[model samples]
Target: MTSTARAAHPFITSHGLKAALADGEEIAVLDVRETGVYTHRHILFAASAPLWRLELLIDRLVPRRGTRIVLVDADETLAHQAAAKLVRLGWNQVSVLAGGTDAWAAEGFEIFSGTNVPSKAFGEIIEHRKHTPWIDADELQERVARGDKLVVVDSRTPEEFAQFSLPFAHSLPGAELVYRIQEIAPDPETLVVVNCAGRTRSIVGAQTLIDAGIPNRVVSLKDGTMAWLLAGRALAHGRHAALPEPGPATLATARDRAEVVARRAGVRLIDADELARFEAEAGERSLYRFDVRTEQEYVAGHLEGWRWVPGGQLVQATDEYVATRRSRIVLADWDGVRALTTAAWLAQLGGHEVFVHAPPALAPRVTGAEPVRVLPSRAAAPLVSPLQADALLNAGQAVAFDVDRRAAYERHHVAGARFAVPDRLQSFTAELPPTQTVLLVSPDGVLARIVAAELAARTHRDVRAIAGGTGAWAAAGLPTASGAEGVLTGDDDHWYSPYAHADHAARDAGFRAYLAWELGLVAQLEREGEVGIRLIPAA
Candidate 1:
């Protein structure tokens, strides 16, 4: 069966979009191409929502259905298709970019090449405006050799810190720096140096401490781990030394300091009533309520209805979390420090009205993971249990296809299963044997079921989804295979980070190019005026 026909949507010219952005109208610009393709070329502010996973991601990225939405791609074809899907999903105000990125570039507008361009550019602007202090790798090494009373803090996520970090560096993610710095470095004279994979988080993390009026001397490690590698320094791998929780005294002091910083940055403090008002108006005005604490803390207990987005990742990837431009954002945490600290940076980021709230003393809390909103599939495919699937495969009566991430498929999959890209399933499955039953599997059975129904309708063949997907297969003592045995589409769905490069020379080159791109963001921001980043004077 062909795709359901959709009415053509209205188009917005590049000039129209530029003016709307300058006027500060609420809008979300989404690029519907696959992630790898989007990284090569895209609008400077567009967020990635690939067509294949659009249903899974749209509710999180663009929560407000009525909010104005502009779809973009390399050409207009994908954008139009995405617009149709959005319209069917209850988005009343959706339009395609007249000619997509090509039109925007032809009109002399700057086109960016990278993921998270807006957030990285905002970081460069922060560094440019605040002149955040920095120390080179040589100086840091010398200080360490001299046994100076100093602490090196990695500002990336705990997972990133575990992958690689500086010698003796502690993992204190960016938002936690302000909330726990006093405890981490109680001695006023002890130096604090923050680092990340590259420039953005390093600068933002160190600046956060300085802005909060910390007495300790704080500086970002220049160029972060990339510079250390360039300086021929070896990094420690598999380290997980996150700082302990702040005590009551430390929490009190941090709250006071963060309040001052938030006030200075013009972050409004709202009570429960005010937050309810914002939630009530969410239908007309886009509102995002986030619990800005560590995932562990958030999972233990959090205000119901608040999404858990660790503050550090929220600041580093604002575009991903809050796609609706000029939306109202409410941040909350048990202690005021995390919410206030995150709000200060977001308030300065501009375009949005940022607020902070502390949950009531006896507010109802939810436990476990946050709930995800996904579009319901039009049809459900028949499901087979692992034992049933194993029997069919053993009899050579069924072919299994794993429709998950390439890395996941490479790590482990059902024996004799071929990896398939969700969007490329039609072309990829055409070469398969026609008589055998087709079995689909994903990380979970959700995507598999959705795609299996579509494939069965199109191919008029027997198709079934593996119940509970690969996890269930592994749990049932089934044989599995590793490595790239049958990868039909290679690395076409996801963007590869510079650090993910396999070859040392290629990885080093990627690091250099990434650093250069970050350094040049400030100049690009200047060329593209009205980008909506405003810097508040550092307190």
Candidate 2:
């Protein structure tokens, strides 16, 4: 945790806090308490902004540098830490009151108590400036049914829309609204409404759109879908957009599109018999099931095999995802639509034996509609699999690649592995063990297949996908890995026959450590236009 560079005020009792509140000053009363504790009670007028994203809120949303930023926390440690983060961002006028809110309450000052409504009020304040209003479930339902020509802007993130939506709604997350607005809802005449599990994104998104001077009418679907369900209004959880796979360019230099493609590609398309047999049997070949969706959505619900990897990030860091690197792939989501798109992209990259998971839900995400046209998969598309991958795995033959997200690769992988995602399959061409057999692995067969196809496109060579994901191997009673979470790379490994561990720490410690490190855990999905350097493995 960093320190606030500005002059910090001495600890003030509750009296001072109350005095400050009554001063009519534009002091931001911040709640630095844990999320659970803060939600139960906080000082009146104080905002409950978690420290994990103090920088996220200050740097991105709160624009004015001189805005008097105050840090308040149930604990002093958090407030001080937050203060430093703000100061580092060059906010000169920042300060944290010593003793924090607990000290204030101890001094007999009034503390605000309630759920996280202040932030909502804050969003409302921003929206009200643009004359934005709130719409109840009935009104929304009526309007949508009447074809009110309103643009139902589901301000909840895309997965939220995919999970559940109102009529005529297009998902535009709060953060992406300003940037993705043109792509999702361009017509100014169309009305837009924001929503979320509750009020946060809805309120924020609606306000943001209005503040941008959008000629369209913008409002929050007040109370969101929860309110809709309670109000007896119909809910329309519809089909989500088919996020495409990352292209060759995107997979390597910009893993953005590539990750999305891999995540959304769903499971490696397996033969029905093979899938059934694998379920009936268990062995360890390092298998993993990745449900390619936003992490938040994955937390809500998902298939058993899926490890959450947002497609965009997968394209960027597949090589680090240890599970995908060594395991056979099975990709899934609310339905197969996204998985198919991801699969296609992976096929181009050359990992064959791809399979798309078929969600049993009738209206998977949007309409639970079944696809009308079933195209032959990439396995059958313009490429063929190698009879065996041993030739590539042999030393000095071909590149032995772990083709998945870098994060997944780093956690657990083949004993001796080389990092490379499908799109960046060629980024390490010079480093590869020349035309030996190029053995590829991924939880999503599509990416592996895509890499193989791309390699073949250049050399007409064959490649192999792990028959079952690494997870499947373990389920089949094969060897598996286990360890405590801290210092993961230092943990023990259960060996696999076909693959080997790379001399990462010994030879490439700096590079591996660089990619393995992150500013935060539970990372947010990378929005478009994010440019920066990273330490993830090859491609």
Candidate 3:
């Protein structure tokens, strides 16, 4: 068992965790291990928070620092580190699980295993309870081969769609389905099929259309793209067709449909004054206000303090946004469709007072400061310009490491810069060639400063950050490479959908695991005992 010497931040016993759960108290239990390990197994209802990014993400994950926070790790090392960081950051009620997850398992509590388990499980429950309709992959493939009049709408983001999708599929991410479907399939005779990398979004998207009473026959692609590949079908790559802007008729239809769905789900439409009242009560209760729209739409213009969270992702990853279960959530969108639909789903999911804020106009008013940007916690070291870095590198006195995501590095990076994984810097340090100085570069200066601080502490070599980041470097007309170079760590941060893998065996295994995880969700829901979900039966 872990020692409880640090009384300032006490260590809660496994029994204490169980008692808190049984009592239905307001608490945030976080599993501070890497996603790879956390996905394998973790205490039920515990949110994933890898120690590497905990500081940067803590504010968003648990906005109320004083809320009782219980951190758990499989081992003692990470939980203690995370707890210390929280206390230093002014969290008054931080605690660690005594003996970590081992202690919890000894007490015989159910430990969940999978990524986005709640969302995936909820999807399974939705299908079982709501009986969402779907067309098998073989049927869809045969229809396509026979040149049927059909429209395939991929319910993933444009970026994901661009990576891979079914042939002739147009990009129409979740929440946009109700708003844009009429334009995509103008003819009622068109057989509309919705698909994602997997089942959740596909089912949700298809159900959204069905609930809206669309004349088009909308159905989810069974088991999503994984089933497509499993049926010996080929996938389309690098597709970019996007949902066109809704015409007047389509927009009016969407608005009317949204109102019906909202009314059915008992979602309230509050005006600006009511929203103000909710915000004023923040001291007594937490209020999470969001603009449920695309990032581009959000960045263009949004209400003050209204952060952007695409409706689909918000529903799919509830734990990331609303850690406090019973807190109030207010959603806003330019159109009624996204906000109303998202509010309906949130209300059905339970534990929160959910509402849709209906503004006078659909276009976002240019109000409020930009969203909070996460930066390094500590002061940055001395900075160097990209030109200065180039000179130092040419002389072999310095080495440059691009600290951005691998995809970004592969898109464009400084010609000689190596792709360095920040999480694995300690292990990768030995592989770096001997140099008097090390230069760190990121998409923005923030990550570089964070990494520079760590390198300065660990090595004797001089460490510095690039003044701006890759954007600045590119603007300076520097030569760049368009592929990943000298990648030091595996890209495990992003858990791709099982349908995304090209390997038949790997994809099959992923689908099986996904199905198994989802199949057991109803049992876990019973174990959790507090998840508020009321399925809106199929219309």
Give TM-scores for every candidate, taking all chains together and pairing residue i with residue i.
Answer: 0.94, 0.35, 0.87
Ranking by lDDT: 1, 3, 2
lDDT, candidate 1, equals 0.85
lDDT of 2 at 85: 56
lDDT (C-alpha) at residue 177 in model 2: 48
Residue pairs with backbone overlap in model 1: 1-458
List, residue by residue over 180-270, the lDDT tens digit for candidate 1.
Answer: 8777798999999999989999999988998888899999999999999888889999987657788998888898998998888889988
Clashes of 1: 1
- Single out the weakest 10-residue window by summed lDDT for candidate 2: 490-499
lDDT tens readout by residue for model 3, 25-132: 567788887665677778766888766566567777777766788898886767877777677676778888988888788777777877766667777777778788
List the candidate 2 regions with Cα displacement exceeding 4 Å: 1-11, 15-33, 44-110, 113-118, 127-130, 182-189, 234-239, 242-539
Higher-lDDT candidate among 2 and 3?
3
lDDT per residue, candidate 2, 1-539, as tens digits? 12344435334445555555545444455665544456444564465555533433443223345555567877576676666656666665666766676786676554543343323333333343334478987888788778776766665546557756765667654434443454445576777777764554676566555544456677887756656655545556665763333344323322333234434333255654765565544232333445665555566666543456654333322332321111345566343334444443334322223455556664233322122221121242232123233333444554446554454565665434555534335545545445555666554444554455445555445455544444433344543342222222221111111112334233234323222221111121121111121111111
Q: Cα deviation in Å at residue 416, candidate 1? A: 3.1
Per-residue lDDT, model 3, residue 536, is: 77
